[model samples]
Target: MPMLDAIKRHLWSIALFGIASNVLVLAPTIYLLQVYDRVLPSRSLETLSMLMMFMGIALSMMLAVDLVRHRLLSDLGRQLADRLDRLALAARIDTHARRLSRPELATAQDVAALRAFLSGSGVTAFLDMPWLVVYLGLMFLFHWSLGLIAIVSALLLVGLTLLNDRLTENSVRAYTTRQRETDQMAAQISRNAEIVTVLGMNAAMIDAWSARRCVDLDAQVKAGETSSLNRSIGKALRQVIQAVMMGAGAWLVINQFATGGVMLATTILLGKALAPVEQMLGSWKQFTEVRQAWTRLDALYRSSPERRAVELPRPTGRLTVEALAFSSYSATGPRGRMLLKGIQFVLNPGQLLVIVGASASGKSTLLRLLAGLWEPQAGTVRLDGADIAQWPREALGRFLGYVPQDVELFAGTVAANIARDPNPAAADTGAIVRAAQRAYVHETILGLPNGYETEIGESGETLSGGQRQAIALARALYGDPRLVLLDEPNANLDADGERLLNSALLQLKRDCVTVVVVTHRQSVLSIADRVMLMRNGQVDCFGTREQVEAWVKSRARPAAAPQSGEQRREAAAS
Candidate 1:
């Protein structure tokens, strides 16, 4: 209902268009019925020809109007959807600090729902209301009692529609769940493709996932079928009721004829009275479905938590986290469980701080807090003298360049990806080339068929591991931020690739940019000015390379000796 109100507020022009279309369509239907007595009574070739010609003209006009309406509605729908997408994206961008679940994926569905809401429910409401009015008015003009019969049937059909709505509510929920599972299955199958091929278990693995997909799809199909069956049954019942009404009207006219009072044209009017009632019953289901879909889509837009904007606190250089703590509650666990506790750190300009930790040690979460991507549940994060909590997201971004472990690339040329936001001043080609060369991705890109102009394909699928990392670093460097937060920058790099990353970090430090790198690689110990080992959600130790290395090696496992020929062969087979 809120969506309907919003649409009605903006669609005054569309309403006028609808009104014109309704008048054009109804004029012919009404004129023909009113003049039926004169036209039908003649039963001559001349009259028949004239009637056929008029009908043909009316039909052509209706077809032309329908085509025009379709074209206009489609264009309007696309524009409306695009506008809503921009609004949604703006809302997301404004709340950039808040962590979002499946953020990018939600945009597709949200935009699609908006388009369907506009074209189907929006235009239909405007166009159909007038048709309903004219249709009922013609029924009343035919005969008083027959008009009442049509109205009663319409009311009953409306009741059936409401009942069907209640019955189909569960189906919508099931459809959404099934769709999510289907998406997950698709992602998993794609990720496990190489594993399945090497193990020669492709058929078995595929069958397992395919069976799950089929089960989910079957549930969706069953829900659809049930909803369809309910609608079909409701329509059939309405038709039967209309048929009985028509039969009674015919009987009444015959009885009047026996009493020498009935007219042929009057009896014909009874059929006309029932026609619109049948159509109203038929369109009722679509109207209800569309209305429900619109309401569901609108509820999200209205109640979205990201719409709020808070005052931003201004921050200078030297980012700091003082006794910062954050907690994440799992759906399967008790609430209020802490993920990070009393985490304190600082990285000033011209400094390099290395955070070393095992996988899932809440290391990345600490980086996010430092980057101001998230607020701590307790304690404070400060930049210079200002609280990070108050800093504007864009202002904070200007100072920090974060590269996550899993780098993402858009489907575009390497040059476009490197210079993500093209500036009027332009990224100096020499600088870009030097950065690429430092990341060790320069020669790899040049080897591609089109060099820097080559399309990376979806998510940089065409690029190798080292190439992807270098591209991501180049993107981050393009901004020339004062602080760089590298989350496992050497994750996908070989020994030579790691050397390139070290060279780039050294260059950044020389430029007076603060660098914070998270890694578990012992090889990176030589490059750090101060190495901090993070464990159990807090800083375990911070000191010189030898001091941290001694502690790390004390707790670390020794390297395994080389295996014999048979052992090596067995390892290979395994």
Candidate 2:
């Protein structure tokens, strides 16, 4: 009942309606039984027929009430699920800047499970439990001894329910681990379907994956059985106690120690009393599942306020990083090794800083910090002298355009991709086309069967890597961000694509945009205002192309290499 407060309004009405309907069904049956005992003692055929007809009518009413109640509960369940999903979505968006750790991702799984529980099990069974409560209470009123016995049996069943909860929690954790492995296998197969088939390892890979899955599934089945057994034990105990109580009650009446009508009523009430216990025991599994789900959803809903804290202020001007440092805890790296340390960088109007280094030199990490995707552990990234942390996420995003090495495009038309710019009016069609033209992708798109209106397949699969890169660049340019961080723009491009990239770089400089490119491509040398060389998470060298290389070769050999004017001429030639 953690988030029960949030959903109490919906729960109250659903539970009340369900309990009322269930009580009404029992009411008519109870009334008919009383009339039969009182009026049919003379044993008239017509009167007996009338009693039978009344019983039939009572049963019909019960069925109708059950149907209506079931439908309402189902609808309520769906609505609650929908509400929770919306809340989860909002929370995710609000925490978009949060780089989730493994534990955080595990918590996200709880949210997903909660959604499934609300839709499938939690709401319905929980709302219906009150009806069982009413049934049990009525039975208690008929005979105090029977009531005491049932109450004790229910307390024992509650213990079983708690045990079931423990078992279910373990199963859910194991299932989550299994699901991650399964998802990885599925993604691998999907990404390399053709390669697997060509290499003739498809069957072997599938066999391996299936073997792992089978092992996990077997463990899950065993845990399920254990849980079922626990519930069964509780149920069997309840049945045993029920039999003993009913037997004792009947024995006293048969021995002429009690009145027949009261005894008969007690017998009837005993069945009704057991009815609640039976239903409650039956619902214990679902109850445990939902309890865990509720716990998870509760945590998310509580953390939602923290996620919404990044939207208070707006940012202004180009981003600048000053003495930024970041460290990621890893098992393999040197102790206390910084991912980035004392990294001084500046991007003003019309300045292009090209960062060239080998992979794992913290290029992407630097871009992330500058883009406000993550807050720096030490030092500050500021826009116009104000810390980016003070800026609203949306406002900061508006001024910073970032395209990572792996470009992910949504499934949409070309126009949609370009207009994904938060403010499309600022990104006119002419502007989008010019950006694409500079990236050398405009004519190719115009020649497509449907031009800009054509649908791109999943993740823009219909487009080549170079084409996707060009489209992404177009999107970045559409935003007109003063600071543009491009991680390997020429990564998967042909000669023409590289030439287009060079042209785009020249235009960015001309437009007075602060552009930072992270690349290892030698061809990108011509567009660099200054090259910063990084090694071991520190800026080892910073200067013109020859100055940096001469320093590198000097470190390699004994004497310093000669700095010639010819190298400078060559730099200008490119």
TM-score of structure candidate 2: 0.79
| CA-lDDT, candidates in order | 0.66, 0.69
Which residue pairs come into collision in candidate 1?
313-390, 313-391
Alpha-carbon lDDT of model 1: 0.66
Error of 1 at 352 (Å): 0.8
Top lDDT prediction, candidate number:
2
Tell me how far the alpha carbon of residue 415 in candidate 1 is from the true structure, in angstroms, after superposition: 2.3
- For model 1, residues 390-491, the per-residue Cα lDDT tens digits are 666656665667788778788877877776643413656666666566556788779989987788887788989778888988777765567788988888
What's the CA RMSD for each of the models? Answer: 10.0, 7.3
Off by over 4 Å in 2: 22-26, 41-76, 83-141, 152-173, 188-201, 227-249, 255-264, 305-317, 329-336, 421-435, 543-557, 560-574
Worst 10 residues of 2 by lDDT: 99-108
Q: Which stretches of candidate 1 lie over 4 Å from their true place?
A: 1-6, 23-25, 37-72, 84-134, 196-201, 223-296, 303-317, 329-336, 383-399, 421-431, 437-444, 447-449, 457-463, 543-574
